[model samples]
Target: MPIDIRGSSASEIADSLRALVERGGLRPGDALPPVRTLAESLGVNRNTVSAAYRQLTIAGLVVTLGRGGTRIAGQAPVAQEGFADTVLRDVGTGNPDPSFIPDPSRALATIAGRPILYGEPVIDPDLERWAQEWMSADLEPASLRLTITSGAADAVERLLAQALTREDAVALEDPCFLASIHTVRMGGYRAVPVPVDEEGMTVDGLRAALAHGVRAIVCTPRAQNPTGASLSAQRAAALREVLGEHPYVLVIEDDHYSMLSRTDYHSLIGPEHRRWALVRSVSKFLGPDMCLAVTASDPETAQRLALRLTPGTTWVSHLLQRLAHALVTDPDARDRVDAAAEHYAARNAAFAELLTAAGIPVRAQDGLNLWVTLPVPARAVSEQLMRRGWLARTGDEFDLVPAGPSHRLRLTVHDLSDDDAGQLAADIAASVRAVA
Candidate 1:
């Protein structure tokens, strides 16, 4: 059956197509008529049909495959960064151990104050001052402006939205953070895969992405997700040199694991770089419920980002901001945070030893999880582990561009007991051999 695309105006046509999707008249993978065919049938101009298609694509209702034509988007669920719902032991959950997170009770008591009214400053003054000093240590003494958002993910989404329009190309790390992938796809932006190696985004991969005409780049400077790769000083300098050719490209460095990361920060932003933002969130140390992140960016980018974050409507709550500041500033809470970093590193290191002893040679890196390379395909070993009551996240789930079968597994084993960790290591070794 043909799609009855009925309407004279762009808005009307978009509404008509949306209705078809809502009513199940058009299903996922169902292709819409060509622009000329739809325009001729509806007695409208080709521009009107094109506008309608653009509207649907931006709304994530349809996908344009260029010469292949537009089709209804499948709406597949994007994988998240937290715990997975499972009865089995979930080693794939990219979560900080609860015991390590600092207690918020003391800070909560100190945050009570007069209710903030609309039109008052968006960011808490104390928080703003502290954040400036914190970010300044890592950044050059340029004209830096600060903006606070709900979290690092929210900051990235808004930063990209302010910088680029729909279909604009963005350079993303291949095997990227799940949230970044979802944000780019939902905004209808093209993601140019920049491969990440042990030292972070490869210089050649970044050059290729730039050559592909990417308008923006999102990279994790330290403790990169899944792979736990950090940019070494040498690699960071090389990346900065490559980016020098495209100084105006919007570079967003999501330093999400800021406080908890054991590695030193190696910045990709050069002293003379024109556009960039470094985002650090309080979620990892203060607990995920403390939804706040501080972003330091070039003055102009900060101004553009502020447009989306209004005084009262969209600005992050001042109370939350104060709470985060109090916790971070307190000596006891700061000590707890430092301990948490050490705790995570030690746990991961111990687990790596366990894996090595079990016949699978492994080395621990930064971040809360271990990115293990298996002798066999990760999916096959994952399946074998599933039979032994364990849930695992394979490397393919994070791949921006599907290569062949992935041989890596991202395991969150930091919170497991010593016995459990040893058992899991042995089980993983068995699973690899079983699937080999």
Candidate 2:
């Protein structure tokens, strides 16, 4: 059998090769037919084939060798002509796996009414009541009040608006959530650094930041993003001890992974605190498209956050509230959500085991991703992984305000099979070796 290359221009030849790739004929690293033979079969000049090969090489579709032959490139970037590219396998961000997001089509079909109008209470009645109960249970206090927001980021933004003004200093865990880092920078407020370790944000770091005049703080109590670190009871107590005198500074606990979290939640905001909040977004467990998060805060801060979430300005859609309530209350979706949580935990642990076997240490205490302590620079490791048919994200992206030097990586293995995890581990070992 012969490949039929029929008088195709360079672009046409490229498209044909791309189709071959999609159809699985030209697998990663598989050699293409010789240029001369392809040219003769297509009844075209050799330069036409040559041009096609050159463009493909530049485009990363094929790789040329001295004599072994030009082969289909492995782990090429998805061509970005116009469409938005998905950041696949990067696991750098704290996004849930596609397989884990609940199918909302069925739920959407059940909504049988007109679209909502502004100036009305934007949350479904049943959902509003249910969310209040859940928040009350999770963050029990005498002055607790609930306010629904679009999502975690929206909650953070609104909280910031109510709590601070331009140039106000806020303490943040060093290498905090990326959105938190960006939010502080974009809002023109100063971000004071509070270091985090295996236990979580350090007491010394917090005290230092507070001493420097920080008025607000964002703390991830469980499953802190990127690092997968959580505040332990001992660390939380120590933090509380240090903050005993600093009761005026507002604390926002972004427990984004609350329900899906593998660890118990701990808060630095003691029972005596006059002002604080606990925010949990349904995006992770209930599907990011759910676009809803509930914030529990003291009455004073809650009133402020509610004011920020004003009727038409930023109220979360009531329809989304209904869907969330329906799905969460449904036994089937609740069970599925629980199973998904366990699945992600098991997958991330398994991936960490493989990494350990490959001699690269990593672990995840409570989050969907593993915090890998690479033996070398993460950028070097990531670049090498790209060569081995994998693209991993570097840790630098999440550093709130990166300090001296750090060599680490945050990888999500939610959708990775055991086979892919093993291959990824092997690549990581090889990448580390190359960097060494």
Candidate 3:
């Protein structure tokens, strides 16, 4: 059996490959012909083959493994989190320290309820009321509607499902949230890379993505993952202006860190944007087990999302929703959440200062993890750190493109004590210097 590339153009080659994949001729993990061999056999330019391969990669259909060559991507990789299962110091897990998460035992006891029948309202009244106030405080004047889902990831999946079709182009940060990357790739959508800087997603990047005809844009306005970059007020306003021209394109702001973020929420959803969703999950502030997120969006989007989460078949559990409401409203719980927020900021900042002193010059802008730029490629540095009995996440894990080797690492060292932080910083500096 051979690939039919006789008179195919770049996109035609991509289409043929996609069809083969769909029909099961080319299985996951199956190897494609080498680029030079395929090009020569097909009587096509090598650049055309390269472009076709690039398309396949963007569509999440195949992956290039350096000298290992290209192979069909088996399945969407589960975004690893909060520590890999290993003996080394687990700094890669982007999870909040268990000690900082407030105990939900009391809230569990308070959630007394009768059996929730299929016809009952999906969202708890109390939870809805609280969410309205919480979301309204940050939004500009608009006709908004509320919807609840299992978590931010669930909300994003549903939002995209309702608004776009498979194979639609979606704009995502280059080094993006794992969940976002996983969601887009698993949905079989084309991911367009938008670069991020210290201030946040770049205006030019967004413009380029929009120019490429992206149907939806997923943005992390504050406490962006991996990099800890937050959208500054100026940056947000500039993005809003660029987006003003594309009012109908769907914009999803995943404010997953929400109350736990030290930076202010600078939203990218402009007032005139017709289709949008702002999702805030309680997992970070309250606890991951709570499994509830509040989404405020245009009424039309809310109505569409509701159709997917009807009462009987797939609504989020009312018990979970009520417990989340109870804990969030409790004064003690609120105070503890606030304290946890402060603690994360302080710990990350302190560790960053130590790294800077060691000549690494890293700073944690915001979020539970610190994104450290290494003097060498992050993978090499991470390998050296492993020799030192430390584990960390390299930035390449979050990239949307196979651009090059990553030069950064995402670390969850905030849970370490001051002495441990100093030692880790020294180890990291040494590892980088060694690798370089």
Cα lDDT computed for each candidate against the true fold: 0.91, 0.79, 0.88
Task: Rank the candidate models, highest lDDT first.
Answer: 1, 3, 2
After aligning candidate 3 to the native by TM-score, how far in Å is the CA of 253 from where it should be?
A: 0.4
For candidate 3, the lDDT comes to 0.88
Off by over 4 Å in 2: 1-93, 109-118
Could you tell me the lDDT of residue 318 within candidate 1?
A: 88
> In candidate 3, residue 380 scores what lDDT?
93
Model 1 C-alpha lDDT per residue in residues 272-353, reported as the tens digit of each score: 9999999999888888888899999999999999997764347889889988999999999899999989989999999999
Q: What would you estimate as the lDDT of candidate 2?
A: 0.79
Which stretch of 10 consecutive residues in model 3 shows the poorest summed lDDT? Answer: 1-10
Off by over 4 Å in 1: 6-19, 29-73, 311-313
Each model's Cα RMSD: 3.2, 15.7, 3.8
Give the per-residue lDDT digits (tens) of candidate 2, residues 1-436: 2553444797788778878888877788888778888987887888989877766765566889869899988983432111124444554555687676677778777765677776666667788788888877766467788788888888888889888876688888877787887677656577888888988999889989989999899999878777778999899999988877988789999998887887878888887887898998988888777778888889899888888877445677677777888888877787878888899899888888888888977775777788888767888888888777666667777675556445888777778777777888888899999989
Any residue pairs clashing in model 1, and if so which? none
Report the C-alpha displacement of residue 116, candidate 2, in angstroms. 4.9
Ranking by TM-score: 1, 3, 2
TM-score of 3: 0.89
Residue 158's lDDT within candidate 1 is 92
